[model samples]
Target: MSTLENDSLRSALASTPRPPRASAASAALTFGWRGMLKVRHVPEQLLDVTITPVMFLLMFTYLFGGAIEGSTGEYLDYVLPGILVMSVLFTTVYSGVALNTDLTKGVIDRFRSLPIAKPAPLLGALLGDTVRYLVAGIVIIVFGVILGYRPDAGVPGALAALAVTIVFAFGLSWVFTTLGLLLRSPSAVMNAGFMAIFPLTFLSNVFVDPSTLPAALEAFVEVNPISILATVSRGLMEGNAEAGDLAIVLATAVALTAIFAPLTVRLYRR
Candidate 1:
């Protein structure tokens, strides 16, 4: 080959891609565990996961239960799942905020300079935040049980419901993570991102029945993904598994993950 052609061939050969290894998983786990340890240093953030669930359970079950659902027992049964879903939804917003903070503080840049896997920070954040979701779910369920909010589906079913909710939250963290990376401002990302989801939770079946809502609001509640998730959760807890409800919730979660995971990875790469 000519010198120019030989030089080009060598460059192409050197640029050939190699398969990624299992070490990425180890890096993800290590970074995720590091995030968990960071949370230990700032334990106050956990208060929302542990305490707010109990407080919301009590507030809704006793204060507004009679006025809305006619009895505290019935209302507790209805709102418990909604509270669980809402707690996870609200908690997921912090993922974006935290991501933005890391970017602002150059923490992500420092990680980028390391030899770790590209997805480590994002994956680790998702895994670490899952602890928050579990704490929130357990506290809410335990308080609900104490307050007579028995799940008709028993322990296994309750656990399944919690698992679905956590998976949904984990998928949602990708969306927030992407937003955080794109925005690069913690307060702006959090406020605007959460503002978008606020109506999704409030306008849904969280505190009221869709059938009782005004026609305009009822249409929104019917279409809201949060409402669909809440319905699926309630169905599981109440042992009334409907094919349509489960399908919708699963579809929404899968769709969100498909859209956000690639976007999040792209953001991380950038």
Candidate 2:
């Protein structure tokens, strides 16, 4: 309260400079690193992508192989790519679940109070999820190879399929991210996510030939985005990808992101 003390405080304050603002990229990366750390601490959640996919691969291949394709080996070759697409899409459900968890735990409010880039946390969390997708793909492919599934297009083809799956998953995540923002409960978001996914994956040509189905069902499965993804993935790994199929998957992913990303941000702000 003294004049001398006030003068000294003013001098010190004048001498100190404000810290520079963080760049959007840097802020996003910092949050991305945080997201990675969350994965490190909660590694068990990975079982959804790893063990579950492997189980599906095994059950579907061995149980239905003889009846569907006359042999396990033949069925494995035809089904592995479709299984990969299903697995990757299943993992995307967690994007919304994680977002909902953070919102409910008050983390989003805390982040909102910070001076960092607005989209940093959202983008960073999604960026970290890219690792999950990559790991799941690698595990499934390796397991497939061990089980006598050989990609005709070989390693490069497998890698191309992996890349496409990741790109699509990245875009598809925004749809869940928006759900996370709008939903009140993480479990609700998770349930809703699966409800949306089940028909897409199961009703697609993931296990059976669409040609064997009724004309109406065959037409529906053929045009489904999940079916298109399976077609593209099977083609890529089989060394027979059509340009139009690949283009459709890419366009679908881009469209999903374009529509949902802004909606998620708007919901967050409100």
Candidate 3:
């Protein structure tokens, strides 16, 4: 080629930005699909997602309902949302622990060497876990119905409630994934993570009414994200459609996603 043509080609190549790097979204999807495929093989994790919710619903609604809320029917109505939130809380911690396991086992390093999307592993872990969350939700809701915890809301409202729970869970996975990336041990991550969530769930207006608690506890419950999420779920399930509660739940989810998604991706890139 002529010198001028060669020079022009080099100049164009230099001026063009490398094609915008592939995002973690595709990577996340791939990772999520892989997890789903793995689940198909083992099928045991499905038990945690599907069966546990039913057991909790039955145990709480039938066993503790009368003592807690004066009637089985009344307590089921009150506890169903709490149980749903608890299920999500329990399931999301796995994301961090799983990521920690991959890191400890050198799986993460292998992933880093591949020319894959930077955020795929983290995103995939989050997405894959959503399957478990959905299964839990389905089980809880089905059993709730069987136990006379009929959602006053129509089908659409119920679906929206489920959507809120999933979105919240997704955001939470990001938080746990970041922790997993930061921690040296999976056990540490699991224990510390649950320690944090346990308080957040219990301190909220989950099983019991916030007003019935002491003033100090009531104040905390009023502001707690878990409480707000539970309120959103209740609103949707009960068909009360409280705009402020839903807004708070959505805002919390978005804020968490904004904070942790970028943080996890940054850590993964490192």
Specify the highest-lDDT model's number.
2
Q: How do all the candidates rank in terms of TM-score, highest first? A: 2, 1, 3
Residue-by-residue lDDT tens digits, candidate 3, 1-270: 999999999988776555666566777788899889888999986887788777888887889889988998999889998899888778998889989999999999999987777777777877888988888888888777777777888667667888899999888878899999899999999998999898998899888889889999899999999988888888899889689888888888899999999998888888
As a TM-score, model 3 comes out at 0.88
| Pairs clashing within candidate 3 | 27-120
Give candidate 2's error at residue 115 in angstroms.
1.5
lDDT of 2 by residue, 228-263 (tens): 898889999999999999999999999999999999
Compute the lDDT of residue 69 as modeled in candidate 1.
78
Using Cα atoms with residue i matched to residue i, what is each candidate's TM-score against the true structure?
Answer: 0.89, 0.94, 0.88
Which 10-residue window of candidate 2 scores lowest in summed lDDT?
Answer: 12-21
C-alpha lDDT values of all predictions = 0.86, 0.92, 0.86
Residue 112 local lDDT, model 2: 94
Best by TM-score: 2
Per-residue accuracy of model 1 over 1-270 as CA lDDT, tens digit each:
899999999988886566565488888888779878988898888987988778888888899999997898889889999998998888998889998999999988898887777888788888889988998998888888887878989997798889989988888888898889989489999898879888788999988899998999999999988888888889888888788878877777788889998998888778
